[model samples]
Target: MKDLVIVFPGQGSQFAGMGKQWFDGNRVVRDRFGQASDLVGYSLADLCFTAPPAEVTRTRFAQVSLLVLSYAMYEVMTEDRKIPVSAMTGHSLGEITALLAAGALTFEDAVRLVKARGEAMESCVAESGTGMVAAVRMPVADVEKCVEEFNSGGHDVQVANYNAEAQTVLSGTLDDLKGLTAHLEDRGAKVVKLNVAGAFHSSFMADAVPAYTEALHEVEFTEPTVPVYSNVTGEAHESPQSIRESLAVQLTSPVRWSAIVASLVERKAAVWVEVGPKQVLKKMLTGAVGSGEVHSFDEEPERVRAVLDQLVELKKREPGLVGLCLGAAAATRNRNFDTAAYDQGVVLPYRKLQELSKLDQETLSDEQKQTALDLLLTIMRTKQVPEAEQRDRVESILRRTGDAGLRTIAGALAT
Candidate 1:
């Protein structure tokens, strides 16, 4: 298919009786769940498939159950659909699931890792009275605006997950969450307290990063068979070294879902499938970027069928469109194409030809506009745009169109 993208869920999507669907149909899924239970030194199936509300919802318990169930579900979904994949990506904890899909982690190894990871994250949370909640009905900028002032209110706070434009999550101290909830509601946003137990992806978990790094190194990593976009850097990684570093660093870094979504748009991924229990990413893409063509595995069968119907027609219309893979981006950059087409827009005004000219500060001309893009990029290259300033810097320059300094700055990033 021409347009294929996959997104996986994080910690919040877990529930009791996770593997019931699989266990009721397949013996292999049942056996695997049993093996995971023994490996974790407890019956995960019992707690997940039979336990009461409290224990099943525990952070440690929820993480393992979701991993096993999600992985098994992924396997079943891929059974007969030998659809050629274009690209793959995952969300916070879903990155592990993507790794399994990409052939980097075995199903057994990933389960073991998540089991240990859950224990570590949960044990750390036991010492601190902290939790997480989802804040809705606000843009990314406004959400950050609230959190910036929230730090001054005497609590540790940070953006945990930028799920979409309107649905952002803020993680911080328990009291800080309470304060933000009241303050945000007053601003007309609808904030919902999530059922999570601790401040994941915030500074409260900073103490866990080192042990995570150690755990990451203990396991050997191999380059993925298929490319996967990472959550921490919003870049595609195909090398073993880069994959390991990104996974280890994700403990302290915010989950960059907005960047990941934007990157997919830039790459022209025409279809996305969020392979999980719920349909959050589909709604998120619709709200944030105005595109989805994404469907969940267990999404209402009618909905999934409708999306597949679109994909069928789309593939017939563009059979040769294998997508603008990042490798192709490197190729075009080497051939001087994206910049060339852009350069021609200024130099030749929508023609495909080369113009060899030098730009001077004393003159404002076509070459000047082209070289201006390079100079602005050179300045950005030397100074790292701080986390808080990146969005503003890009936006301010973009809004001030036609001004050479601002146009150059925005063009530098657009390419």
Candidate 2:
């Protein structure tokens, strides 16, 4: 699906039996758990499937288990389906999952890195005595003002996550956060203490960053196959170095989730898939883009699959040879050519393709379809589009349409 965005959830989304369905139903998931256990020196399957809530909620266990499960679900969902993911992103710890899914990091590297990151954060919690609280039904500006007051008072509190328009998370020493409750309540906001270990995404997490950066340095990052939005920057990472740097600072930097959602909306993201435990990201997406279609794989795998299948069928039905010609003509950007020859070679063919696009697909004869494909090829050639890109466009169109004749033509072009 075009403009499909895949999102992953971070900490606070974990629970007992988070990935039991995938663990039991898919061999690949089981294998991933097995491999992850070998890397982390613990039975991740047992941790996820049988552990108690308290045990599973520990940061050290929660982070790696969540990543493994999320990655497994992503693999299972996309193994057979050619989902054209326009972009991918995750919240906090989920960013690592997104990186792994986008091929920026290997499975082994991700497991080891997350394991180290979780342990480092747990250590930070033990040393710092910090905590987090969710401030709901409050505007972010007000939250920032409250945090500024706290910081000005030398309390070291900060806004950790801009989750939604009306929800923000604050992180600091437990006493400072507890002190905010009455003040936030005075402003008609609800303050709920989060069940987390430390003040993540704040100065309290500074101790965790050095070790996490070391862990990051140990891994070799590559370019992602798809655009992966960064939580630290609220934008797509420009390079592997930028990914590393953003991740290095992510421990103490606020998660700009609202900005990320806004960017996705600006990009015209149509369908959103949350490939992690619970519907945490889905709820946030709904808050940001009201009535946006979001499918949570962890909460409803069958429904997500059905929805995706429907999308594939609809895509196949809507775009025919005429649509393909128009898409190809639009995609070819090279324009350095002779003006007179271009008018006769490209302009006339494009007009014909536009005329053909208006009529019903069923009414178009095979000859007309062939003519449309020829016109698209002619336009590509006149525009000086590279042969490889032209082939890719034609093959993509053929796959979407399931047109055997077009596939034959595409195969001939491949040669």
Best prediction by lDDT: 2
How do all models score by TM-score? 0.72, 0.79
For candidate 1, lDDT tens digit of each residue in 1-415? 4456767787777666665766788766677678788877888778877898688778778777777767776666665444435567778888888877777777777877777677778877885878777888788898788878777767667888887878888887788889888887888789888878788887788777777677677766666655578988887773778888888778667898888888867756767777766766666776554554667776654565466566555544541211111112122212223554445432342111112122222244544444433433333333333423433433322212212122234444545
Q: Which stretches of candidate 2 lie over 4 Å from their true place?
A: 314-415
The deviation in Å at residue 380 for candidate 1 is 30
Clashing pairs in 2: none
Backbone clash total for model 1 is 0
Runs in model 1 with CA error above 4 Å?
289-291, 301-415
Flag clash pairs in model 1: none
TM-score of 1: 0.72
The ten-residue window of minimal lDDT in model 1 covers 319-328
Q: How accurate is candidate 2 locally (lDDT)?
A: 0.84
